[model samples]
Target: MTETKTIQKTFWQKYSTLMISLVVLVIYGWALTGLTFSGIQESAGEVSSSIFHGLTHPDWAYVYDGSGEDLVSLILQTLAIAFLGTVISAVLSVPFAFWAARGKNEGKLHPRSTTGKFMLVLIRTFPEIVLAIMFIKAVGPGSFAGVLAVSIHSIGMLGKLFSEALENMDHGADEAIYAAGGTATDVLTLATIPTIMPEFLSYTLYRFEIAVRSASILGMVGAGGIGTPLLFAIQTRSWDRVGIILLGIIIMVTAIDWLSGMLRKKLV
Candidate 1:
């Protein structure tokens, strides 16, 4: 009876993986059946040629001539928007993080955390483009609208990141403080804040890199950035201008990513 039972368990184990694999394959097949493919356009070749010609002969004049609509100026403005948005979002994420990652909920279900987690999901799910349009309508189109959109959109991601950091944090210092009859303020200043600040800073720096890219895109909708001029160039069929703007954005984003990486390493 023992040998029979052992053989039966082994047989199930051997087939379970195959069964799961078959199910996954079926799901993928079903999903793929719903996809629709579009054919290439007749003007695709001409459009591609124009784009390549522009890239090969980028408008060097657009870099800077103090027109204020130049690539350099617009790129700088985009960076500023990203920086402001990142800082504001980092600050706002703190309370959300703490609320979602409460120590008391460890190893157990907590409705407060569930609700907070759901709220974060909702925040994240709200599209940044939509937020930008709303802000533009509310405060008129400009860099300020972009800043608000980026900051608010960033909260969901940053809050989730910060909460994970908090959950993984070393609670030993917190306990040590409590055992020594330390005040809550003492625990916060001595243990809680210090224990998590570095990680928080690191995450903020990482998020800043994403913010920079987002800021550039937000400008497309008149939130103000390099995107404004880029869109204008596209609409006007001035492909060279678009090429220069794209180059500038690439250089700026690459530089910021490198700098953010260095800062994150230091903080970590």
Candidate 2:
């Protein structure tokens, strides 16, 4: 009886978590089914043809946009928003990350405590589109709004990753610095930053890739990017134009992904 009980316990320990996860997934799938479009079957044939045709025959003329400002230029705008946003977030996240990182101290006001965690969570709760809309109201619809939206969203992400990197840094040097009467700023500047710089760079590059995609989507909301024109092309049934814009997005994202991946491998 004892042996049988032990076997049963082990089996349950191994499979109970999986069973719960399966149950949760089933429930979510059922909910999603209810939310799915009921008319998809009716529209799928026509939609498929339109999409297929558009993708196959993109307008090369729109690819360069005649005089100079074209799909490429708009894509460059998207890249600029993402680049600036990532830089801004990377710079701003440092202090928040240090505050959020777990350290030697403990208790409510201790440096080791997660006092900044709540703030980070709050910031991340709002999606980039929502933030873009808000910023559009504040700054008007343009690249500025897109930049602000991406920057704010990037901050939450960078801060979380940065804090994790800080928490996992070599404590020996930091302890020595503290013991030698070094200030928090000194330790961070000299020890913490150096130790985590590689990981920080890797995360920043990854975030920039995501920001590029996000910048394009934010453009759909009038935040300023190729998305506005892409939307217009779609609404006007200009599939040729849509194809050009999509191709531009695909090329830009692919190139950035490749470069960032290479850099990350070298750094990390």
The lDDT values for all models are: 0.91, 0.89
List ranges where model 1 is wrong by over 4 Å.
Answer: 1-25, 35-38, 104-107
lDDT (Cα, tens digit) per residue for candidate 2, span 1-268? 9999999999999999999999999999999888755465877899889978987899998877455458988988999999999999999988889778777555546644456877788889999999999999998999999999999998899999998897777789888999999998998789877889999999999999999999989988999988999999999988888988999999999999999999999999
Candidate 2 residue 148 C-alpha distance from true site, Å = 0.3
lDDT of 2 at 135: 94
lDDT of 1 by residue, 103-220 (tens): 7445546776777788889999978889999999999999999999999999999999998898888889988999999989999899989999999999999999999999999988
Q: Could you tell me every candidate's TM-score relative to the true structure?
A: 0.90, 0.87
Model 2 regions lying over 4 Å from their true place: 1-18, 21-29, 32-37, 40-44, 66-69, 107-112, 177-186
Worst 10 residues of 1 by lDDT: 102-111
Predicted structure 1: lDDT: 0.91
Clashes of each: 0, 0
Tell me the deviation in Å of residue 207 in model 1.
Answer: 0.7
